[model samples]
Target: MRRPGSVRTLLSCLSATSLSVGLMALGGGAALAAPDTPPAAAKPMPAQVVAPYFETWTGQSPAELAAASGNKYLTLAFLQTAVPGSCTAYWDGETGRPISKDTFGRDIAQMQARGGNAVPSFGGWSADTTGTELADSCTDVDAIAAVFKSLVTTYGITRIDLDIEGDSIDNAAGIDRRNKAIAKVERWAERTGHSVQFSYTLPTSTTGLQANGLAVLRNAVDNGARVDVVNLMTFDYYDGAPHDMAADTATAAAGLHDQLAALYPKKSSTRLWNMIGVIEMPGIDDYGPEETFTTEDAVTVGKWAAAKGINTLSFWALQRDNGGCVGTGGSDSCSGIAQDTWYFSHTFEALTAPHHPHH
Candidate 1:
């Protein structure tokens, strides 16, 4: 509910270590999509991959995000359409117009000028048609592509994240339409000499992506879309256990490593790991202590991912990284757990410090 695959048969078809060479031997199975003809230019990732979600909460802004972590990447959350099918207008009031800039537009420009860039994340639990919902309302894939193209062109963003969750993740038709629309965008990028990377942000089980989530990723590749990253929202399992948060995270990421290796047969183990992202929800979750994610856990997971070369590391809203809570329950502004200001943020940010460039 928050910020939020495949298997043995394929292993017999090819080896995980030398998957790149095995694609031709296997005639390009489900794992391969016969690299696009003439080969399209590779879509690019963010200027800096590690970006925390910045959204509705007190004490959180683009400037706050830039100032807090000192990192170059920040994900400006929830850029959706004003209406389900109204592609020309965005939910943030920055309609495809000139002169007047909405809060998001102004702040993003400011953040960019500070040597930091942002990824316009489409979707969240809030109102507005998420990326999938917007695509579902339109049958014209080109139109859908145009909406995203305008966003990337206007904002100068190199990547966009599709945070698919709730009803949107299971909408099979929407998933297919969304994938087709993304494929069109990739093609458009190829023609325009712009590098754009598309990332899917979804929920995960301890073992990795659940069935619907797996389907979402498969839909992307089956429809001829290249997924640059698969970011897992690794909290709120809601199983009601006092689980070892960091251990679960490492296990979940390992499972995803295997799945990515299976999905992209030609990718090396290290490269596949580099395409994985983990989004942590700092402090006590809505489920309380049964699902707590402490700062110590953040450090553990950060070091684990850094050592393994994980693509990006982020968390839920940065507003919750403080200690304004009066009790141990979920709050939008501050972490329910007892902690100092910016404890989680600083710990996780340290994982991406200069000495740890591999992260």
Candidate 2:
């Protein structure tokens, strides 16, 4: 399932727009825990984190998989409205998983109890296209901001990831509403002494973010929102050319570095790199053989990510880290390549060292 919410391909999931400057550069550093201190629920998202996307629809406990995968941080995939017209968002758009404490609340608390956390993400290919994306479905800016606030208060989590792809990227009104809500939430966080950060997870071509993704950031800047991390889906280029998945990630990230340099001109090159995040699909993506990310590639990217001092290193999912379905192009449960389970997780988790990020 080469997809977001399962991305079959990124080509159809994207479009372009112009770009801006902003504040809130995400550093790759976190406060060291006191030797005798208890694990805090309000742990700040590390300056550099290895948070792979965790698919929520699979009925697996996120904390359980995270523990199994050796991932201290997992970006929970998609909280969107159950219907196209609703302002309320539910996990996987399921009513049973509404924005309530009963929904994955304990799971998140459990993760935090130890020293881990989940980055709750919004919008995926399904939500972006079906008009279920929050900003696209709900025009009320206050309501959108309320939902974001709820996550902070309910989960005590620090970062929110917006996986904007498909028509959502091309959507001007939705883009503006989303960013405006982001600004609103950031302002509230600042006033309340809450530590919250927002990350944009958008699709990318081989070189970098195309126009549509840039437009979203431009809107965020125009609306006075702070974008902490710009996570790129470095897979699924879909340009009908052979891909060196690892090399493409480097090129794409370098391209994003340049784009980010312009959008955040006031920041230093190091800060701009620190603001970057690269998400690989792990094994074969929706585009088949041409875009396969071999195990060796994962090794390359992981070490490269650490050396570059990037903000985050992640894959399409935690579940898809095994070699259960070899030769397959896309499968939600396996990497489709020969590799040990949790290989990607173990490889990239090194970037989260207490001493790394150099900031």
**TM-score per model over all chains:** 0.80, 0.89
* Residue runs of model 2 more than 4 Å from their true location after superposition: 1-6, 9-40, 355-359
Please provide, for model 2 over 62-134, each residue's C-alpha lDDT reduced to its tens digit, 9 standing for 90 to 100.
8788888888899987788878778998877776667655667777877887698889999888788889889
State residue 52's C-alpha deviation in candidate 1, in Å.
0.6
* lDDT (10s digit) by residue, model 1, range 1-359: 32221111100111111122211111211121132222121225532367877752221356656686565577766555555555443433233322113334455555666665677776654421233246655567777787777666555667888877766777787788779989988987788677778888877888898888888888887999998888887777766567888999888889998887777899998888888998877887665677788878987987887788888888876766787884655565677878888787787776667676553
Task: Report the error of model 1 at residue 296, Å.
Answer: 0.8
Q: lDDT scores for all predictions? A: 0.65, 0.81
Residue 277 Cα positional deviation in candidate 2, in Å, after optimal superposition:
0.4
